[model samples]
Structure formats: C-alpha cells, structure tokens
Target: MPAPSFMGIYPPDSVQEVHQSLPLDPLGPGAADLLAGDVEYRLHYLLQEAKKFMVHGKRTTLMPEDIEHAMEALNIEPVIVPPRPLPQAPFLAVPIPSGTSGAQQQLYTVVDDEIDFATYLKEPLPPALANSAGVKWKAHWLAVEGVQPAIPENPAPSSRAGPSRLPAPTTGAASLRPSAKQHLTTELQLYFSRLTAALIPTLAQLPNLPGNSAPGAPQYSFPDAERHRLAALASVRSDAAVAGVLAYLVRWVAESINKTLMGATGTIGCLIDVVEAILDNDVLFVEPYLHQFLGPLLSILLTVPLGPHPTPSGMSPSPFELRTRAADVLAKLVNLYANGYPGLVPRLLSTLKKALTASPFPSPLGAEHPPAGRYEGAVLGIGACGVHAVREAVWGTNGDGLGAINDLIGLLYPGEGRKNKAPLVRATMKALLLLTVPKPEGVTAPAPDAAAVAEAFGPHFVRAFEKRPWQAQELMRLRNGGGAAEAEVDAAGEEDDEMEEVQA
Candidate 1:
C-alpha cells in the first residue's frame, strides 16, 4: 500500500529525532514522515477533546486531569503528566532557529539560585494579629405579622424601599418585639425570623372600617394552618440550641395575649398556636423562661369578653374555641414540667378554683374570681388536669366540687343562683364526667344505679348526665372501677358529637 498522504506530509526531521532512542535502521521510503504524521494526529486529537471538557466545565484554562480524561474517552492508554507550573518570572519569547523574521513562541522561565533551609528559618514571623472575635449573630423581626417596628436591625421607617401597604399596630403594641439586648449567629437569626413570621398574626386592625361599619376587620392575611404546621415541625427539629431566643418568643406570646384580650380581634388563635408549638417542641429550653408563658396563658384561659365574638357572617373565631385550646396547652405545660416545678400545678388549681366559683356579690375576694363568662374556661382548665385531679381534687362526699358541678347545672333549675348558659352547663358536665375516666388505681366495684348518682352529685348533675348517656355510663364506671359498661361502647359510640368533639 502507498504511504498515506497526510502522514507523508509530516516533518521527517522531527520523526528522525524521535527515532534516535529506538533500536531501528534509517526510515525506508516515506516511513519517517508517516510515523511523524501519526504522532501529530494523536496529539491534535487529544488536545481538541481536552478543550471540549474545559469549555464544558466553564473554565478558560485546561487542567492535566482534563487531558487524562480525554485520553480515556478517545480509547487511548492513560498518561500521567504533572501539571506545568506557573513561571517564577515572566517568559522570554525566542525565534524558531535562534534568529528569524517571524516569531515561533518558545517559553523560558526565570529561576533563582537555591537557598538553604537554615537561612529561611532566620527570618521573622508575621506580627501576630490581635485575636479576632469568633462569629456572632442576633435576630429580630424586620416585619412581624406584617407590622414592621422601628428597631436597630430594620432600616428607619422613612427609609423603607417603597410605601408599605401594611397598617400600624392599632394599640401601638409591639407583639413580636425583640429584646433590648440580643446575641445571635446568622443561622439563629434566620430561624427566628422564619418561625415568628410563620406562627404570629398581625396584632392590630383598624378600630372600624372606613365607609363600612364592620368592626375589627383585619388588615392583613396570616399564614394558613398548613404553614404553621411546617413551622412547628422545624422548631421541634431545629431548636435544640435556641435558648438564647426563648426570651423573645416568650415576650411575644405575652404581648400577643395582652393585646388580644384588650379587644384586638382575630389574633388569639394564632397566639395559641405559637404557645402550643413552643411548649411541645422537645428541644426548646422552656423551663427557664416558662414563667413568662404562664401569665399569658392564664390570661387567655380566665379572661372574660374576649373579642371579636363570632361575627354574624361567621368570619371571626369564637372566644370559646380559643379558651379551650389555651386550657389544653396549659395542661400539657403543667403535666410536662410538674415534676421539676412542684408548685406549678397547685398555682393553676388555685386560679382555676377561683374562676370556677366566682361570686355575684361585690366582695373584694369575689372581684378576684373571673366573671361568669369565664366560668366555662375555668371548668375546662380543671378538667384538663386529668381524671385523677377530678376524682381527688374535685370529687368528695361532703358536697365538694360535686356541689359546684350541681349548682353549675343551672339550665333546668328554678333557683335564683341558676345559670341558663348551655356552654357552661356542658363544660361542667364534661368536668364531672372526668370522674369515670378509668384509672390504673380504680376500685373494683359495681356500676352505680341512677339513684346512687343523683344522691352523690345532685339532681341537677344526674339530670345533665342522663341527657349524655355516655357521660352517665362513665359515672357508672367511676362507681365501678373499670366498669364493664365502657367495654359495651362500640366505634359508633366513640364518634363524639360536635360539643363533645370540642370538649375532648
């Protein structure tokens, strides 16, 4: 076969120089040129492949690994070549044959004479920098429930990027205000901002809408229920190191409660959510700042006339729902921290006892008890303490809390002390039913008859319980330790009514 033309065109002199190391005779015919052409083609192909990788990597320079990778892709044996180091001094360009009209680029690096290691050690070390402080951070809201406060972290109110659409807080209260002093890292700041924004609602609304007499209409939308769920999950998982920010959270809760109780509409539900999530999170250091939570929670539980009462259009939350939820959260808090803080449950019991039996007369002590509207909240608070509290703390033979429950069953009573409130009577009955919530220490006895229940609690309670057959059966269970009557309750019976659902 004739020598390939492309191979034949390659420089023979170059091939001859390469051939010096080989054990071979002088090239026969165009063999040297053919060998040179093959070498040239391989080198060109390798570089072109490597250049593609460099471009793909979005880099201007090709690396040695790129060449190796190119060889692998092109089905060639790998070559391990060290990277070409940068020149110590600028390169000096030289001509093709020592002197030429046109330039052929040849790189020459400047090199310095070698120095002994001893000479380098004699030089002075750099002046030590005064130790820099480690990284630190703090977080306060730039916008909380859409209301931005004038704080150090936020820009001046006038300096905002554009005119803010959000209204000022109605009561001029800063519900999510950060503490006067704070220390945080970038991560904590981010977490605080996200969690608060997720959990809190706007604290203010215009007193009344313009050209619309709709009282307490909210100015901004809050995050939906699903968003609060995700935020709670994040808090539970990520707040192990959140002790520093606990104060801010507690303060926010307190401010929210006070503001909501003072006729700020539509934020109590959001505030209760925040409280529940904070207490439920295992990682939170709640005890140190727990006292801060109690005041706000108790205020929510025992306050009367919480607004804005359910609207005619059914747009706003009922105060009753908020109180019940707060009571549940308070119970959880007490149950969880009771072992460590012995006085916690007792204080709650004392406050609840007062609210449960408030006097209509104008006595100084009577004034301390919550008004009649809060009677239901108080009953819920007591019942949330569990069946044990109901049996021992509330139940007694000598007209103990049983009388309170009887008198509270005033809907059908003819006496002047009777209360005609359906919600209160239901709450009272639910509390009374707690007596039968089968306990580990329950006494083994027969289920009580109607005569026994009426004699023990009172006619009013028996009347109320008779209406709630399950409750009356539960009373039988309390009379008979772990009553067999409870076993008769099927899944159909387990599905509670709407009132029972709320109470449960």
Candidate 2:
C-alpha cells in the first residue's frame, strides 16, 4: 500500500475521537480522514478572513477584536460559553499504579467528585450560551419572506434592500452615463469644509489683543500652527483631493491679493504650509500638476507690495517679509524640482530680473528706481537657484549667460543710476556673498571665480559694506576669500562639540 499523503497537520485519531464523542451511528468509510481535512480547510479559511479584518483596521498584529469583527462581517454567529464555578474538591491526589516513571506518578491526579454520572447527563443544557459580557444569543429573521430586515444583526442597508425595491434601468445609455464635474466639485467643497473645521482650532489661533476677536478675523501663529496644518493636510490619503484643495488655496491667494495684510498673509501662509506638506510626502505623486502651482506661487513671490502698506510712523517687519517667505518656498521648489523642469529656473531668473530692473514710479524729480521689496524678492529668488545655477548665470556656461552677477553688482554700486534703498542694498550684498562663497564639501560645483567677482564689484564693494554695517565684517571677509575656510572650520568644531555632548 502507498504511504498516506500529508494532507494536513491535523491528526486523524483526534478527528475520530471528536466524532465518537458525539452521539451518532457508525461512521462511514474514510470519515475520520474527511473530517480532519474539513477541519484543516475551515481553520485556514478562518485565518484568511481574520487577515482581511486586520488589514481593514490598518493593523499589523491580529487581535481578538479583529477575529470578532471578521466573524461579524461574514455574518457568522459565534458560539459563546457561560462561566461555570469550580466544584468543591473536584480533583484529589491519588497514588499512581506501580512500574510508572516517577515524573508520571507525581503528575497524575484523580477526580474526587462522586455525584451520579447518569443523573448529570439527564439534565438539559441552557438554550443560549453567555459571553464575558453576559450576552446571550437572540433569534432574529436572517431573511423574512425573501426580504432581509435591517436589524442590528443585519447592519448592511444594501443587503437588506429587496430586489422588488431595486428598480431596473429602462435604458442602458442612461445607466452608463458619466458623473458630472459638478458632483466632484460638490464633494470637494464638502471635504474642504470638513478639513477646515477640523483644522481651524489647531491652525487658526486668534490674537489675544482686544478688538481683534471679530467674526472671521484673521489671526495666525507661526511654525507651530503651520506644522499642525501640514500634518493634517499630509494625512489626507487621496492625491486628487489634496490637489484640488491646493488648487483652491492658490485661487484663494490670487483673489485675496487686494485684501488686508492680515487676510492675505494668513492665506499665503496656508498655501506655503500645503506646499511644504506635499513636498515632504515622498510617496505623494504631484509631478503631473506641478507646473500649475508655479504660476500662483510666482505671483505671490513677485507681487511688488506683498502686503498692505504699513503706516510710515508704525514699526513692523517689512511688507516684503511675505514676499521673502513666498520667495523661500519658490527657492525650495526650484532646488528640488529644477532638473525635472528644465525651463523652470530660466523662467524664474527671467521674471526675477524683470522685477529687479523694472523702472519704479517716476518721481517729480525725473528719477526712477525699483522698489526695495521687489529687489529683495528678486535677489532671494536668485540665491535660491543653488550654487551651480548662480555660477552659470554669473560666468556663462558657453561664454554667454545672463549677466546676473553684473546686474547684481550694478544694483549694489553706489552713485549708479539705481536707487540705493537700504534693504535693497543689503539683499543684493547677501546674494553676492552667497554666490561668491565656496561650495561646501560634498557639494559638486565649480568654485566661484574670486577674480571675476572682485573685478566685477571690487570698486563699489566698500560702499555696499558701509551701507550694511551689521553684516559688513563677515561680508568683507567672504569677499576677501578667507571667510569660507574659517566658516567651515568653525562649523566642523561646532559639529564635533555636538557629537561629544551627545556621546557624553
């Protein structure tokens, strides 16, 4: 005879014993084997169903609740057992028979209860078993007269709906019709409503100042609130939904430009928060509509007066601060995505130059100068282009590049036709310093041409430094070519100290 195939790990003897435990007639041929196989199959099926439950709950480990939920979902009624009290002196220590191992003899015990076995058997069992919560099975119609009832037992509404109620479509074309964009728009609106409501408390902290608590007032806190907003936005699973929200934000900023500074700043801040969240998510695929974002982002960055005009007598961070913030976002986008969109950097540079050099309001004195806010935005945008792009812009890749270095130098030059706004001069100096500084180690870029930079701005460099006295010392050191090395050494020492502190 052939050896029995390993159908499963379930033992046939165990199956036979279970079968014999039940009060039944003689078993048919191969009944034990059939029973073992069925038990194995059912156990495997139960595990597979339990796994679906785990995944549905976004869990890694299987829990008892998962199994319960799985059974509930499958419409399987679970068998529960009532708690029973222990009988007094149920087992008694008894002497083992001779010739048994000492270990076996020590382990053996006998039941001492001597109630009538036949009398216990004659008693009827409870109709329904109780669970830990003392819940008992209650009978309800699984289906009544071919119609499923929507009871707690049958929770699915679609399952309860009868065929008679489900009307058949009269025309195939009508049934096959596509949903309108208005439906999508309505759904998006609802999603945004929920999202805004959920995020408002966390993201929109009102200022504590008196008289600032009016309805729909714009009050925002930095970094913390922004972080909360980004986290909330990133948690959204649908890419298209997130994209729709982002598109709406862009439109919000575009429409809010003429609004109050408080309003425009709040909305622009939200836009930047959303962009940061999208970029932070490595799995989020936004490449397809990335270009669509550029227009709105650039518009915010290049807007001449980013916020409402501040009172001449009042002191606050410049209106250009908003433009600067938006410019920073633009720079990050360029650095991360420049290679993918070849024209992006060039277009940005073109737009920035135009903004920087465009004649300012004609004065009664017949003088024209670019606004400091515009100049700052343009300079920061250039700096954001990374070292290589800046070098190429300065020293042409093919002996002919946009003379960005010259333009910047000309802006910085004292007594030049350009207006000498303190902020504009400071920004230009910072941009030049960024361009001339040595590329950090591990960064593969051609070193800035010290000779070319010196020759270009050496004559007027002192005037630029005197204008920004606070940063002059560092700026002069950098321009003289000794600062980068010193800076690197200082940075290395700081890092070493940090490492030592962490180790200690």
Candidate 3:
C-alpha cells in the first residue's frame, strides 16, 4: 500500500510501542503514523548533524558522543542510556506477551559478567616488570671529522660500510681530530707516525746505482734517507715500548714490499731493514706477530716478481743481494725466536723445503730445477737455521738413499754471464761454506784427506769448495763434525743394547 511521505523512515509499529510505553493514553490510529513520520524526520536531521561531527573528527564510524553532540547543538535533550560495563555485552531474548501473530524477535546487545567488588579490591595487580633492560648511556665516536677510527667502540669498516672501506690517511685539520685506531695512546701515535715517515724513502733525483751487481759478488745501494731510515730502524729494534704499534708497522712494511718489489727502486730493502729493526728489539716480545712477517719476507726472497723487471738503481739491491739479505734475516729471526716459538723453525723449514724441491709453488707444471732465484733463497733459508739443520736435513739420506738436496746441489748447471749466471751454484757453495769449522784460538787444523773430504761431502762438494785452502779446512771441519755425530749415534745404539741385555 502507498504510505505517507516523510524525510526519513521509521517503523509505524515501533513508534506505537514507544507511545504505549509512556503513561499517556495510546495514540489514535492516524496519530501513530504521523508520529512515526515525525520521529524518522527528526532522527535523520540529528544524524545529518552527527555526520558533520564524524566528518570533523575524521572518523568513518559514528559514536554515541556524536549523536549527543548533535542533540546538544540542536537544543534537544539527549536520551539517558546507561553504558554497559563491557562494550560488547550481549542482549537477552526477553519474552513479551504474544502479539496477534504469536511470534517473537530476538535482540542482541553487549552483556557483561557479574563481578564481586570486594574480591576485586583484594586482588593483587600484576607485578610491575619492565619489558626490557633499563635505559643506559655510553660515549663513543660516531665519526671524527668525517672519518671513523678502527676502535672497538666504533663499528668495523667491513661490517658498517663494506670491505672496501679501508682506513684512509688524513691530513691537516682532519688528522688533528682524535682518529686513533683501537684506542692507541697519544705517545704511540706520535712515535708510529714519526717512524713511518722517517723510514719512507723521499723519492728524488737518485744517482743511478750500478746498473746491476757484478755477477759473483753482488753490490748494494742505499737511499738518500738511509741515515734517517737506519736511525729509525735502529730505534725500532731497540724500543721495547713500541710493541703497541707493532701490528701496524708490520702491515705497513708488508704493503710497502708488495708495492715496490717489481719496479720501484730501493724501497724494498728499506722495508726489509724495518723488519730487521723490529727483530733486533730484544726487550720487546714479538713472538706473537712473527707469523705475519713470513709471507712478505718470502715473496722478496723467492718469487719471480710479476710484471716487467727493471734494472737496479740508487740503493736498490740486485735479486741475488735481496735473496742473501732475506736469508740472513730469516736466519737471525730463527736464532732469536725459534727457541721460544718452537714451531717457528719448522714452519719456515716446510715453506723453504717446498721451494727447494724440483717442483715447487707453481704446482703440476714442474721444473728440472726450481727457479734460480727461489732455489738460492731456499738453500740459504735451510742453512740459516744453523749447522744442526743442515746436517740432518741436507746431509742425511732420504727415500732415494741420498739427500734430495745433496744430490741436486751437484746437478746445478754452471753457466756464466748476466742471464746465464748460476746463482744457484753459488748459493749451494755458500750453504756448504757455512758449515766449515772456525779456526781454533791460536792453532790451525791440518788439511783434510782428499779421499775423506770427498767421502764426507761427496765428490762434487769437494770440487766446489776447492777454490781456497781455508774453504777446504772448513769442509774438513764439517766432515769431522759429521763423523763425531755418527760416533755418538753408534755409541747410543750400543748403550741401548747393553741395557736390554742387563734387563734380560
């Protein structure tokens, strides 16, 4: 059926129910319909106003406060409805007297459970525990003058940025900023800075040195900064207190060696001198960082440097000279530190041994003889360990019943001239020469029998050392020393046999 038009819609039955609830007499038939239309229009008007409140508050959902606000603005009394304790309290399906149709409707509402106020007041509140540890403060540098120092407090360069974020050298005002690495003291920083600066060769017009050392006796040159450099090295060798910057100094020298080894003249020797200086410092305990020195030292001694090889100039030493210097350094290092660092000698021996073998570093592609440069270094490295090592390792028999090194030493091809110069032969001769016994205080030992000399050191060794009488005497000394060691061994075996018999 067509119904009366209104601004908003509300159920006619609902309006009549409200009217009936009032103490006033029920509305007339047409009055209920009119009232409903009026009620719907008023509700919609208030809602339209409430919508403004909702829009002003920037909310999509409407609240009871919005309705009340609309009513207040309209000068209308708002309904007094008690709020439920819980927002989501469920409504009950209260039954009413059966209507004409005898049907009932269910209403839903927020419902709350009953609580005992007396028990609630007595209940303890949850312990007030913190969600995390208490807030605290600490001081550390974020970055000093746009550069970070490698201290424990600061993030590591690799982790914070990337592996490429190396600590760069700063100058002027930037350097003045407190950028000490790992919390180094002010004095160490100054000492280290001075030492490094003084030792570094000041590149100038270097008077060209001997183009190359004369074949047999190699010559060496020194840089203009040799005085300051030597002084720096001497100070480093003696300064017990400089241990704090040892790692940095070692790293600096290693990097310098790598940079200069191929072409740059004179710098390689200076860096090595620095290492010797550090080794000389007896008061300082350097055993811990000694391993870091091996790779660079060996590279200078052995490896055929990559890239274009250049002629020596200024104080730049020849390859032969470098190998000699490196061998001496290794020897000195072993003599000083090997006793304390038991494995130091063995580790060096292993690397040197590999270098000495027919096939060394460059694997499967073997050489009849290891490269001349590497072979010379390895021989010196072994001899540097002292007479005892040379005796057992070089002179002693191997799987082939002759020492691997002993047999090879005789095989080195003897050729002369620059490119054909046999440094390997010279090196082998030097190793044997090192074993020669020193002359007694006033008296001298008679020359060894030629037969015995050949017997002890092999015929090739005897021929090699025959250049000088003193050389031959040293050879005899070496033979005598070997004979004495052999006698001792025999005696030891006899003693063991006697002990076994006595026990029986």
Candidate 4:
C-alpha cells in the first residue's frame, strides 16, 4: 500500500524522474509509487539510526558525520559523482594579409582555463566537512625565567607579575591579599545554578517537620529529594575538574548556616545530603582535599544556635537535629578518608567533647545553663564513628575518653555537676546502647564489657529504664549474659526502628 498523496513525503513525479534516470527499462505501471514508499521507509530508518549517533556523541543537534556514521553502521555507501570538464572558449582566427610572407603569418588562440564553469556548477561539500579548519600544532614557552609571558595561552597580563611578587604596601596592599571565601568560577556558577534549580522543587516538597507534621502538610514515605541530590552530585563527581566546585559549595553552605537566621537547619541537612552523594561516588578522588572539609564539618557539629534563636513553628529542624546530621556527615568523612588524614578522629572527638561540656555562662551565679542540643550532637557524633570508635573512646590509651563517657553518663542523673536534661539523657542512652551492642564479625576489637557498663551506670540505667523499657531489657540481657536470644534480638531491632522513626 502507498501513503496518501496528501502526505507529500515522496512525490510521484520525482520518483518517476529518478526511475527514468536509471539505466533500465521503463518501470511498469504503479512501480514509481512502490519505489517512493520504499524510499520513504529507508529514509525514516536512516534518520532514526542517525539520531542514535547524535545521542551517543552527547550532542543535541544532528550532524552530517552522524548520518555518515549511521550509513556506515548499516553497510550503505552513498553514490559519489565526478565533476564534468569545463567548456572550451570560442576562438576567432585573424586572416593573414595577401601581401605578407607565409613564414611571417601567425595565429593567436583565446582559452578560458582560469574560470571553470563545471567546478562552480558542481555540488558543494557538506558544512560539517567544509567548514572545519585544519589543526596546526605549535609549542611555546608558557613562562620565561620564572615569569609568565603575556601570551594568549597565559592567564595573567605582562604588566602584572605573578602572585609571588609582593605589592607595595602604600599601593593598596589590602587588595592584593587572597580572599577569605572561595568564589565559584563562571562555569561552576552556571553548573551550581542549574543543579540548585533542579533540586529546588524536591527540596520544597520535603515536610518542614521531619517526624511530625500538621494535618494539612504533604506526606511522603521516602525522601523525595534524594534522587535529585544524587543526580546533581553525580554530575560533579563524573568530572574531576568540578571537584573544586563541590568543595566551594560545601564552604558556601557552611557560610550560609552561619549567616542565615531561619531555614538554615533544613538547608544544612540538604547540604549534608550533597556531601553524602559525593562521598558515595567511589570513582571520585576526594581524598586530596578531605582535610579542608573538616573545619566546615566541625563548625556545623559544634556551632551554637545552629538554627534561628526563635525558631518559627514547623519551619526549621531543631538545633539537635541539625547538629546530629552534621555529625553523621563528619563520621562518614572520617570512615572514608581517616587514614588519608591523620588525627582527624581525635580532633573531632575533642571538639565535640568541648562543645558538649561547655557551660553557657562563665560563673555559677549566671541564670543561663548549657543547652541540651549540644550534648545530643556530641553523643550522636560518637555513635556515628561506629562501634570500634566507641570502644576505643571508652578504653583507649588516653583516659580522657573513658572520662568523657563517664561525664556523659553522669549527665543522665541529677548531681552537683550539670543537671540532667531530657534531650541529653535520651541521646546519652542511645549512644550507650550503640556502644554496648555486639559488633559483627571481621571487626578485631575486644568485646565490650556489658556487665562493667551496667555496674558503672546502674542507677542511671534504672532511671532511663523507667522511661525507656527497651534500654532496660537490653541492660538486663547484657548483665545476665553477653548474648541475646533471637526473640530479644528481634525486639532490639524493632526498638532501633522506632528510634530511627523518632529521630527522623
């Protein structure tokens, strides 16, 4: 069957002309329509194949090379016609005079070799082949005698010496100083703009209240922003040069936390998600600058007033929650690149302990007391370092580790020291539970002394048990025997799930 004439895809007259040009007998009746239909089908198929080439090249516009590649893939060769020879110019011969000698007679012929009409009439090459300029390889010294020349290839101007030369103090030395904050390059700015635009809708969709929401707030079973975050970070990870952009973005996020009053907490959470996405990409080489991130991560973990002083209703996450998320990001960084950066673990632990134990006021007469959010952040930070980190902190060569644990436990009970705050108490209980839990195989640490922990913090455990039965059951199991039965394990798993829900 033939396509309708209204389609006008392959005109019957053109098909007939093409058939007539071939060196064959005239086609039978209706043969031109069949040939046109076949030609249309093959053209569509070729175009589809050409589009595949364009997509494979990561290009949006189709090119003649794409079409050629498609033809090659299909084992098809296009016909090439040679150009015709140019026409000869007309000649006019002058007759020799009757009186002139035959030997003296001469004739002149006019030729048109300079201008070839056939060359002008021949088909032109495709733009893809004709418009391309030839590449000429050349080399030159980028720098001469430790000074870069002001060439097209060099970035700096000849009038200005490289950064090593000190500017005169009288001539505005302040302007010569390096900027304290990192600035995104033009390319990076564009990338960041696109990524943030892509993420805005997803971020907006996340409920302001993590675990609790008003009756009308939108609800979701999973994190809706996760996919967007992964895609944005994956783009950065795929390009090595963009790694610096990721670092700059991290610093920018940290600065935002310090500068913004409201909504900084939620923004920080999103930034942590970005960090996780980058870290999760195993192909990215993040170890070189991993140390630089420690400062920002520590600041997030220990920064007081992490959220607004007077947080708006259901608009921001709690200070504890923000710090907890920061701590989680820090732990992941440590676990992934700790060996690359020595003393990271100890420095983080020290910073967290100071924040946890710091008093709000200088003297006892002052009415202000330490905020419970800091303690919770500190406890969660410890737990994020994994069970081995917990054991080392509790039984390492440095006695301060154990002392820190004791201090944390002491905060759970009323005493002459800092009074027990509920948030701190709950956080401490969870941290202790994580520390005492049996680690899986392949970890070479000595088993944690559950009985010793029970004896040391028995009264505090009892107090916490009154409020949290799950902790009490675990403590009893640990004291009676270090092993937990299947049922008890299942119950503990359920309790962990509940805790995660509450934390979320």
TM-score list, all predictions: 0.48, 0.41, 0.50, 0.45
- Runs of candidate 2 with Cα error greater than 4 angstroms are 1-181, 185-188, 196-266, 310-317, 363-370, 392-421, 436-504
Clashing pairs in 4: none
Q: Per-residue lDDT for 1-504 in model 4, tens only?
A: 444333448777888887788766667788777777777777888999999999999999987777877877898764332233445668766656667555556466674457675665465664433433443234668879998777776676534643222111111122111231235565655665556543322334545324544466566533545456546667755646556556555555445444432334555666566666667766667776665566666666655545543445675566766666776777788777676667877777777656655654332223244344555676677666654454444323322343454555564333544443455555566665653445455754433344544464533333454565444555455445544533454566679779978998
Cα lDDT of model 4 overall?
Answer: 0.56
lDDT of 2 by residue, 1-504 (tens): 223434668888897787789866567788788777777776667778989989988999987666666666676775443334434544566656767455545344556567995786566544333323355445579898999887888768755444212121111122111232233476666665555543322213423212234456566534444445545666553355566655443333334332323332444454455565566556556576566667766666565545433322322234565566666777778867887889888887887767766655332223354344555667667766654444444324421232443454454333555434445545555554543434445754333344543453543344554544334443434445545634654576568679978998
Measure candidate 1: CA RMSD.
Answer: 25.2
- Judging by lDDT against the true structure, name the best candidate: 3
| Tens-digit lDDT track of model 3 for 50-166 | 999999999998887788789778987555534534465457665565667867766655466789977775664322211113432345688889998778988676576422222
Question: Which candidate comes out best when scored by TM-score?
Answer: 3
TM-score: the better of candidates 2 and 3 = 3
RMSD per model, one decimal: 25.2, 28.5, 27.4, 24.2
Clashing pairs in 3: 88-110, 89-109, 89-110, 89-111, 90-110, 90-111, 91-109, 221-315, 222-315, 237-281
| Alpha-carbon deviation at 154 in model 4, angstroms | 51
Instruction: For model 4, give the RMSD to the true fold.
Output: 24.2
Better candidate by lDDT, 1 or 4: 1
Stretch of 10 with least lDDT, candidate 1: 163-172
The best-first sequence of candidates by TM-score reads 3, 1, 4, 2
